[model samples]
Target: MLTGNGGHLQHLCAQCTSCDEHAPSLPPESIVQMPEQNTPSGRSSQICSDRRQCIHGISRQTNWVVRSSSLPQRHHIYKISNHFDPIFKLEAPDQISTDGGTNLASEEMEAFFRRWLVKVHLSSAQYPESNGRAEAAVKSAKGLLQENTSKGGALESDKMAWRQHASHGDQRVASCVTGYLQLKEWTNTSGIDRGYGKNNVKILHVRREGVVHSIKEYEINTQLTLNNDKDYIFGDNSDIIATDSQKNTVYILAKKHGIVSPEDFALLLCTHFLSKYPYVEKAKIDVDAYPWRRIVSEGKAHNHAFLFSPEIQHTCTVSQRRGGSAAINGLTGMRVLKTTQSAFVNFVDDEFRSLPDMKDRIFSTIITASWQYNTVDGVDFGKIWANVYKLVIDKFAGNPDTGIFSPSVQNTIYLLQKAALDEIPEISKISVTMPNKHYYTVDLSKFPEVGSLENNEVFLPMDKPAGNITAVLGRATKSKL
Candidate 1:
């Protein structure tokens, strides 16, 4: 329902369109099956009249070109010319405000309205200009639709139509985000906090950035067994390897061991120290690696690199004690954004909540992922990095032209970790932290004409107070399985 400039209630109805390619796919159950029984797709050819104050409830005419019961449930996103024609065919208001759902979202859907010269303004659930009227309209409309469809009543079409409309949006309507919700339901009240235990090697919780080595560079931090009662207690420097020697060892060993990948180099350093100094009990080491590329000379990349690009960096950590086995981990950073096909909605609804359910939004995030390796054997670190990197990135940013639907950073990051683990068995557990980079649409209500012209093209970026989301996923243990 839309509140007019005069502060009067104006009713709005849903037009359930086909799946948006960018929209997260709905559930298998939610895939609408055109029923065998004949029920008119409620629609009329009458065009909406130009009146700010429209009718109570508009009769949404279904412009179904094909009326076949044999039509299989939709699997792929297709642009139906006039599919799920909206109920607003009768009275087109100056603007239609939706609490949430597919309207004024997809390019094709927008084009459908452009042909009729109707302005599409997406109302924010974060900031409700109509106070509570926008929410009231959704609640009241849903209540009526549910009442009509109770016990499989005659108005089942209304229920079906409503669902189809809702499906065009995120979790509430239908999408992959629903799966995360289901997972959440199965968990404790603390909400999706997970931890894994592997009994061999200890984890060295150390991370330092900007390490320089070669074209590939790293900074190493080590925890040496300095004081062990008898060793350093007697003022003995025998067991303790000199810091100066460690420095020389790094430079001298670089020629013999060779630099391949960050993980390999890190493993080399930790193993060297452990093997050389037996009296030194525990040795925990961490390395951060960054890449540099050659500048483009004409059309080809120069043989000798000159410049550096700010791309995803790799992380490595190795911990080895005297008798215990070694533990090594790898990590990658993904800085990405999609102009469309991401949303945040259906969160807490308390007095403290000011942000609304944004149906479509400018979503960008700096994804930081770290995963523990199953074994520190002769693994191809570079190949594994490339494989996992492609999988994580491709899943988030689909084809360059079109991006996969990402409802929340939590859900998206979960998918990223899941994809990496499922595809690569070398990693046993993975954790990803994605901070929501918010871009608010510039308020164009002041200039309605300019707003209609520019549409959602203009936006304001936010740097401070970013929403932080993190999740950890691990493979099931044998006993649990």
Candidate 2:
């Protein structure tokens, strides 16, 4: 039964009438009158009712009722990991915080329980009346998680176990529980950019392609203090042309001159590289120009572009990775570090997970710079350096996200870069490279596959690609570590 925003119960018939002393009122489309008390089947919470005055045994109404009746129950699950705590708290403090606190504070007891209660009112599933029942479930969950971790199962295993135990009843209840659990899991585990964290990444390579341009300019005819007491006169005129990845169209001169900096020059190069390309929303510039200098004549700096010898080589790279669940990568490889002070511990245990000692030191990172802007306006080198400097030092000393870390070098790099981008607001994205070394073990077994165990084939090579690949994520840079 339903009413306008609320409910309105009318009169109830004291006795059931079998078409006696009652003119058979036409069976209305729906029933609005209250149930009579004498009937075997009184209004047992109105299986289905509307405001009309008809009483039908059953009717097909909204699909929701049918769907609810056929739904399967689900139990909500969550993680209690080292990195899980800080990420839910500090990563996006503004967005994640509720109730005026940085911690993962819940609004009410129900709110807290609701996250794990998939089928809240399932007819078959039991509801925990006291904290003890919840605690017992948690203990079991923790054990399961620990077991999974010890067996090297992924975090998803923990969540899946909870889901498998949820109720299977009506569709409505099942859907509600499924949605609630998923939301809670995602909210808890999803990084700033969906579920991707540094652990989900691979490599970041930043490259500065080439700049193309031609210049014709005048030389400085200045009288300077020379060894021969002669006026040091530089060339009076010059003309040159060059091209590279960026076809920086250069005007000879005498036209409108634009203010240029290191960043500006870099942008010019990027503009040329991307102008004729396809599917590029924008280009990120990286200026790894070999250090070049101009002559100082008569106490004035001469205006000249630094040129590298054709025989020598310099390197820079730019890339992008964008999708809802995909990583955002642009430029990487500026600064990276692991602090000696951080630690990991007290993670939730499950059937397939394990927990390390809380006191054991865990690694953290301060990724230096994100990607350089490949544009003429110029990158804020000052800002880039500032972020790099601060993160390199601060990430180690302060709390860093611990969830994403692993003993593997790849995991560390990914997590650090992710943190750098996530923690720092300015940096938009990062690209990264991680190397994995294969440690080979001597085959002591007399026979090959016949006697060999699962991990018996120990082979370690520093130059191998065992899941080590470059990752290019965007929306990284200039952010605090």
Top model by lDDT, which number?
1
C-alpha RMSD by candidate, in order? 31.9, 28.5
What lDDT tens digits, residue by residue, belong to model 1 across residues 423-470? 888888888888877778877777775555445888888857898898
- As a whole number from 0 to 100, the lDDT of residue 400 in candidate 1 is 80
lDDT of 1: 0.52
**How does residue 239 of candidate 1 score in lDDT?**
47
Candidate 2 ranges beyond 4 A from true positions: 1-262, 269-287, 291-379, 389-406, 437-461, 465-481
lDDT of 2 at 358: 41
Candidate 2 per-residue C-alpha lDDT over 1-481 given as tens digits, one digit per residue, 9 for 90 to 100:
1111111111111121211122112222232344343433332221211112111111111111110111012211133223233322222111110122212222442354244321122111132222122222223334444544634556655344334323334211212221122222312322322110011111112222344233322111101011110011222111111221122222211123432333443334334434443322234333333323445578865554434332211223332222111111132333333433334455567787753444423242223233433331234544554465455344333345542234444445555566666765555556555433333344547677576644433543333434344565566237586
Q: Which segments of model 1 are wrong by more than 4 Å?
A: 1-214, 230-236, 323-327, 447-455
lDDT of each: 0.52, 0.30
